[model samples]
Target: MSAVGLTYLTLILIAYGVSSCSSKEKTQRSLKIAGLSLWRLLPLLAAVFGLVGLFQVFLPPELIEKTLGESSGVASLLLGGGMGAVAIGPPAAAFPLAGTLLSAGAWPPAIAAFIVSWVSVGVVTLPFEAGVFGMRYALVRNGIAFGAALLIGLLMGLVL
Candidate 1:
């Protein structure tokens, strides 16, 4: 397992042990709460993944690489960020697509920009964000995320 997963497991074990030591009732309560919460969120998580799978159909991997690879200069990086902003899907789909683009001769900075923008500033989810957090806050957050992605991409491209 990943270090993060191991760490989380360890923490959970420790917590369970402590609760069990205190009293069996606490342990049972904790497990019940966890199970109930997971059950409650399962449907929402499934729906989100379903939406992500549907969204991935819009962007073809070959086209992404071709467009990003056509120019290695700053234009490509900017375009990568733009494309990422428009493209919306889950992290599981984005990473593989970014890897494919990288292997297909897309520039590192452009790939970085795409990955960062895809995670951060999501135009496709903007309406939901605006509704949840107010339009002004969502706009400002997305604007910052877009600029940060470009800067991060530029640095990664130049430095690495």
Candidate 2:
């Protein structure tokens, strides 16, 4: 487990100990409900982690380098956007992926764009985003994010 996971476990243990010592039925009931909520959330979290692991295993660094490496032009931008589209994991997964890409010779601009759009503009999450924030809002946000990612990538390529 990660350090954050361990820390959360420790905190939960401490809370459980204190709650159990209190001998209050209401508190116990509340704790049970909270535990159930955590249990329900666990599966989704596990799936996300599993997907991240799968991506790391299947999409090797060399493939990313071959596709997006040192290409300064429209092709590089499109490659970056496509890479961003495919990457659906959290920051934890993205960091390792970015490092691997860098080691495999992917340009900084492309990697930066990929990382930014990977997090900021998610097609997978679009339905939920649209539901919560309206379709127009979601569309505009994604469009701007995609454009910004390209601009940032191009600027980084020029500067670095």
Candidate 3:
């Protein structure tokens, strides 16, 4: 396993040990709940992997590079955010897709914007957000998130 993966596993083990020591029954219940959650998430994970596989096969590297590569410049950052804002699915699935884009020669700035917007902008949830927190609040929050995503992308570009 990768170092990060190993580290996470070790931390989880330590936490579980502590929990079990404090209350075996509660720890067991927690484990059961975790297992059930994982079971429910399995389908979404499988579908996301399938989507990633399809993207790898169907999206040509040249096309990706031409559209979102270095030559695309600052414009690509906006494009990336726009794409991400409209993209469906959980943020967990977007990571692999972002990796694929990077591998395909997409600009780091664009990928960074894509990730940030995917996690924060939430175009798909706009209606629900508006319903729960008023239209003005939703729009303002999304607008701020989109702007922040671009700023983050610019920073990433400079750093990377």
lDDT of each: 0.81, 0.78, 0.91
RMSD of each: 5.5, 5.6, 1.7
Q: Between the candidate structures 1 and 3, which one is better when assessed by lDDT?
A: 3
Put down candidate 2 lDDT per residue, 45-156, tens digits, no spaces. Answer: 6766676567567877666666777754577677877678566866556666666667667788888898899999888888899999999999999989988988888898
My TM-score estimates for the predictions, one after another, are 0.60, 0.60, 0.90
How do the residues 1-160 of candidate 3 rate in per-residue lDDT, one tens digit apiece?
7999999999999999999999999999999998998888889889878978987999999999989998988778888998899986778888988998899899999999999999899998999999999999999999999999999999998897
| Highest lDDT against the true fold, candidate | 3
Worst 10 residues of 3 by lDDT: 88-97
Clash counts for all predictions: 0, 0, 0
Could you tell me the TM-score of candidate 2? 0.60
Ranking by lDDT: 3, 1, 2
For model 3, name the residue pairs that clash: none
Quick one: how many clashes does candidate 3 have? 0
Is 2 or 3 the stronger prediction by TM-score? 3
